[model samples]
Target: MATEGIEAVFLTTHNWGKAAKFFQALGYELDFETDHNSGQLRNGDGPYVFISEIPEDQETQTQIVLKVPDADAFRADSPVEVVTPFEDTHYGTKEMTVRDPDGRLWNLQAPGKN
Candidate 1:
């Protein structure tokens, strides 16, 4: 199955406030925020960005989210190496992890089953 392209970008930051302000300065508007120091932002019609705060001791990372119309179909037909099977997320999506030839981890997101 072919991916529907990038759905969003997931970013990890040590300082939520600073990261938010930085994105805001870049013309991204806040979409929603959670009490746990995380939020989504967007610029125009492009893919949204989801930022989460992590402990200062941990290294921050950025991940690109690929959109899939159906996880089960993709899993059954795609040749991508699946690192983790699709699982329902707290934010209400089904997500799976895959590894590229370079060993980079990529996340695939699909709408949760009704």
Candidate 2:
């Protein structure tokens, strides 16, 4: 199956407060926040924006979430390196993570799996 579209943009930031403010100023409604360290924001439609604090000793990076029809099939046919195998998330979706040649992370998600 092919990717339906972008589901979300996961951002790793040094300052979660600053990042949250930035997205909020852009009219992204706050969906939820966790321990003041991470949050999910969305406009009206389309993909969401997820901001989180960078892990210690890890360089900040951005991740894109792609909505797919089937996470398992996508992983099986994908040519990229699989960083994480298909699994169910607490948020009710099946997801798999892959890394590009440049080491960029891409999360593939399929709805109603979990």
Candidate 3:
């Protein structure tokens, strides 16, 4: 069988590790871990929570990752100007990032791309 898509829901927090711990306490299993200042936990029914650490001086963050069928074309088709092109993630995904007018970040990912 072919691999299915994956979603990385960006959950903002002062401390991503702590945020992950909180969710883990609630039964979310650690689907993957990373040292790229981000990590993921899975509730098993929906997208995995991807916690990204933010700067102390920066405002809070709100973001989510959509598993696109074709990240490359999506980058080309998105109405919003593509801010970041497809890049390999440390945890394991090829992704592109886009920011809305409100500064909401969206990650378009093609998992297991390596």
Candidate 4:
């Protein structure tokens, strides 16, 4: 199945406050913040940015989230290597992880089943 394109970008930062402020300065507005040091931001109609805080010892990284209309269908027809099966997320969505040819991990997100 073909992907619907990028849904969002997941980013990890050592300092949530500073990272959020940096994005804000870049014109991305905070959409909502979680109880944990994480939030979603957006600029225009483009894909949103989801940022989360990580321990200083851990290296921050960015991963692209691709949109799939149905995770089950995608799993059955996908050509890439599925690193992990789709699972329901606390934020309300079904997510699966895939590994690219370069060994980078990418996330596939689909609407939750009704």
- Highest lDDT: which candidate? 1
The residue-by-residue lDDT of candidate 1 on 1-114, one tens digit each, is: 678999999999998999999999999999999999999999999999999999989999999999999977874656789899999998799999999999999999999988
lDDT value for candidate 1? 0.93
Model 3 alpha-carbon miss at residue 68, Å: 0.8
Quote model 4's TM-score: 0.92
Q: Which residues of candidate 1, in runs, are more than 4 Å off?
A: 75-77
- Model 2 C-alpha lDDT per residue in residues 1-114, reported as the tens digit of each score: 578899889899999988999999989989999985999999999899999898668899887899988765663655778888888887788888888799777888887553
- Summarize candidate 4's per-residue lDDT along 1-114 as a digit string, tens digits: 678999999999998889999999999999999888999999999999999999989999998999999877864655789898999998789998889999999899999987
Off by over 4 Å in 2: 55-57, 72-83, 99-104, 112-114
**TM-scores of all predicted structures:** 0.94, 0.79, 0.63, 0.92
**Relative to the true structure, how large is the alpha-carbon lDDT of every model?**
0.93, 0.85, 0.71, 0.91
Lowest lDDT 10-residue stretch of candidate 1: 71-80
Q: Give residue 35's lDDT in candidate 3 (0 to 100).
A: 76
Ranking by lDDT: 1, 4, 2, 3
RMSD of each candidate? 1.1, 2.5, 4.6, 1.3
- Of 1 and 2, the candidate ahead on TM-score is 1
Q: What is the lDDT of residue 15 in candidate 1?
A: 89
Q: Pick the candidate with the highest TM-score.
A: 1
Which residue segments of model 4 deviate by more than 4 Å? 75-77
- Prediction 2 global C-alpha lDDT: 0.85
